[model samples]
Target chain A: MLPTLPLGPFIFPTAGLVIIFGAWFCLWVIEKAALRLQLDAQATYTLAVVGLFAGFLGARLAFVALHWPAYQQNLIGILWPLTSGYAPLGGLATGIVAAFFYGRARQLPFAATLDALTPGLILGLMVISLADFLGGPGYGTLTAVPWGLSQYGVRRHPVQLYELLAGALTLLVWWRLVRGRRYDGQLFLTAVAVYSATRLFLDAFRDNTWIITNGYHGWQLVAFAALLLSLLLLARHDGNQ
Target chain B: MLRTRFEWVILIIVATLLGSAWIMMSQEPATAGSSLLTLAEAPIVGHPAPNFTLPGTVGQEVSLHDLAGQPVVLNFWATWCAPCRVEMPAFQQASVQYNGRAAIIGINQGEAAKNVTDFGAEYRITYPLLLDTDQQISRLYEVRGLPTTLFIDADGVVREVVIGAITPAVLQDRIERLLAEAGNP
Candidate 1:
């Protein structure tokens, strides 16, 4: 179902289109954030360009690492994102880290920039989840729940939609805070905490439950930790003001 | 302390992202496309089969596993897949020829039970029907196009996976090689 990347001998997925949409939307949000914060809009645009490239590279690299054995035999296939795989988390991670380092190299305030970019980041994640649902991968377990999707022939939990809805709600919260809240980075903290908490619960219905501690991953625990730490940072940032 | 805090935050984010990436990567099967021959690697012959399970008309559960310990022939058909209706007689013929040596499992991808059952009855298909209800099995095996056939070995390792429509001769030749490998005396 829209598996490969490209059109004919190649297959470019509608899913990739969604990913670009997410990135562009994030860039637009970043521009807005920069204007509101009185930061240079040029810096935001630079970050977006660099971050997008870095994110693509990072996502591909992460996919290759995870599926090294498969890619090893088919070296040429690695060039195509559809042939290999795509990891949103990996892309986001690499993008943010790259952007941070790039911003630092340019002598920009990394924390302040990150604060402005948070809502956009959340929105990007939500959009990607929606794409995943459309592509028929990254879905959760099967169930008899009324809302369960009848994919193929059996009823399955619409885990992708759950994540999407959760993401939308998180975005709404972030949007509200960014629009009206007095605190800088408050929306960022709320986005992190809300998304992390939703992800933790939604992961239950996911078919690929990476068993770590009590059926969770080390990453989720870290997300929980981030939620706590970010809240504290927001408090401190507010205190400074 | 300030620098340390920043480093910790970055490290945490990187680690989480890596972890999520790993999960997505693991979703693809490792044993895909390791077949020896080039012609065998064609999407029609070498691609992965749509994995599924269905309840036999007799009420006992039959699945891809039920055909294990013998070379298994998996055929995905539907009343709608034009080629599927045409391929039924060929499969029926092969089933009779390969009886007791290897089992033939017909998996219905995206077809309702009533439609599949009626189609099976119309074609006089004697083999067991497996339901890939949610297409979980289909997703697992990477079945893109319809009318797929997978040739699984006695050990449940796929010897060859076929996609698209198949003929009686093609099905029989493949079955003969598998039966020969099993040392059928």
Candidate 2:
């Protein structure tokens, strides 16, 4: 995998480049989906932008909190943003909270907002999968399949491709059937259910998936739970409709 | 009926995964080796730290194996990289804190020893700084960017590879993880 690209004597991290483009593309997707869902596209974009900023600050603060002792001596180091020190869980929690508040303040319907985000979410996942494929840590288990992409050494499963394919399929399904849906959040729930199923299948083939005790892939378990929850919500919504 | 149908779908997926777990699964500990060591002989996680002896900025030639039975941190840095400069103090501080328990070595990338010596003096960096004048060591380690740091456990297995500037907090956390993995802490 090419981690860095050398163009005109300056080397740029491939992941950084991909993410810059991916963020823009994902926002574009959210804006378009927002219009389709009859929500304010600009407002949705602003909510996402705020969520990202809050998530970044939350992640940095969480790291400082965890390693407070280390930062006591170098007080200015807390403001230094170059170093790698972040708590992802903190970022995720804060992002959700911030997004929720923004949506409410703007008088956006919760389920409708979620529906607007489904395609953008899928696009984000696809971008991450692509970045992982290029600058790794997302390679898959060994495989003898003809389409296997090489990573460590021997032929390995192209799990990123599998993920991208799944995202594309879900997005297609959403775009096609989202119109006049039975309920407001039906499309989001359906997409999540489908994504969770694919993830459960794909994580089994991934080499570096987070694993829990007793032969359980951590993501597989999470995906299973997500799949169940999404299906249940979708069923409830469909029945109510 | 609709709920029942969805429940059935859930049950089928659960059953399929449960059955497939027997054949091949990601949870098997044996399959979990250095995530980065999939490439043959690459100095990635789960692989032995590649062996190389480089001339220390001061005088002595330092070999990675010299730090055997102790955690080792190999910091690939350049004098010109600002992030590298920012983190050098933290590395110096950590080397003193975890001295003897861990070996923290700085490999200067393609810089003249005089410049490094001056920089070290300015920063008061006391760690053994080895010179990679030709960047052979960095190339071997596949370090594309400066300010890359590799944390190796006592067994000499590369545990973590961090690119970009490393804060004191992150540096401490990684070193602690290395010590814990090495069973010294």
Candidate 3:
């Protein structure tokens, strides 16, 4: 069983700390990248702040839309600060939108700024997966595999950790691409392709309560479409920048 | 970027009004307005039970309206709810003891059906169990707490609602009273 910290009667989640540190660390890394890229550090900081807030709202909105019945009676409780129900894909989508819009407002080149932010996004994902592993929510399928972990009560695959490892591997690929400057926008495309591919496999192990349509887990369908779209966009945009 | 002092004051006033309105609408109620309202002010009892049809255990079809002729006891439970496990044996005993006098329906909320089946094996609860995997019934009942039970009369009016572990005695007595009221022998 995972140990939870308590403040009086209420338990303060350790995963919450992990999330805070993850966001902070990502912003710090992005700030450094901004300095190196000769972009406005203040503007980068502002964009990060905006992304955090907007991403949180967007994630909650998506969760609510999917699970509206859960929130019908206690809409106030759903919006409470400590309540947890974030969609990582939703958050990433919103963060990317915020970053793009903020970049435009700040007169930053969208593609180059995306490249600069790639490493930070990878770090953010690593921390998210790690935090989810500690949290009880994102448990995986029961497996006879030797590496499977027992979470809450049952033995299951550590799919969150698998995701973390995949993220780290993607980060390494992004780092190499950024350092070598082999191809422009390669880091961003790789991030999308790699994460989507990883998600497609990882969701097979994830214990999802709701299957919306076509025997596909809700997120898996999103990941599949995303992978296709990312591949198509990369093919179209590559070498043209 | 420069604004006149009057314009700034008006802007500040408008912002304050909007902020206050937002806060008022977003906050949960602190007090009840009527006798039916409890401390939570939630509609747990005396409201019409929301009708739902879920796939019952053993491939049986279960519907809320199907149990309308008899007093129905709707229990919202899950494999993961600790209190639900604690209360299951009591419900099982009550259901068996009551026999045809009442219907005990356990609606499994937000869990895999296999997990629920395993849990049922452990608890040995012999009642009509419905699989509410998407939490449709849970939402209908406005269930904020686990192990919630609704006592519906023969006429399909919800008589009482219990939010926690209920003893077999209290449940049996409630069912008996409802049955007697309905002129059942």
Model 3 CA deviation exceeding 4 Å by range: A1-3, A6-10, A36-38, A57-98, A151-154, A237-241, B1-185
| Residue A18 in candidate 2, Cα distance off native in Å | 2.0
Q: Write the per-residue lDDT of candidate 2 for residues A149-214, one digit (tens) a residue.
A: 754467888898899999998898888877757778888988998888888788888866777776
TM-score, chain B, each candidate: 0.69, 0.82, 0.74
Instruction: Give the B-chain TM-score of model 1.
Output: 0.69
lDDT string, candidate 1, B49-146, tens digits: 33345666546687665566688887766677886776677678778877898888787777677777787888888888767667666666666656
For model 3, residues B95-123, the per-residue Cα lDDT tens digits are 89778878999999888878888877778
Candidate 2 positional error at B127, Å: 1.8
CAPRI classification of candidate 2? acceptable
Order of models, best lDDT first? 2, 3, 1
Cα lDDT of model 1 overall? 0.66
Superposed Cα deviation of residue A39, candidate 2 (Å) = 1.9
**Where does the lowest 10-residue lDDT sum fall in candidate 1 chain A?**
A76-85
TM-score of each model, in listed order: 0.54, 0.89, 0.50
> Could you give me the TM-score of model 1 versus the true structure?
0.54
Model 3, position B158, has a per-residue lDDT of 72
Candidate number that wins on lDDT, 1 or 3 = 3
Error of 3 at A214 (Å): 3.0
Q: Report RMSD for candidate 2.
A: 3.0
TM-score of 2: 0.89
Model 1 alpha-carbon miss at residue A1, Å: 8.0
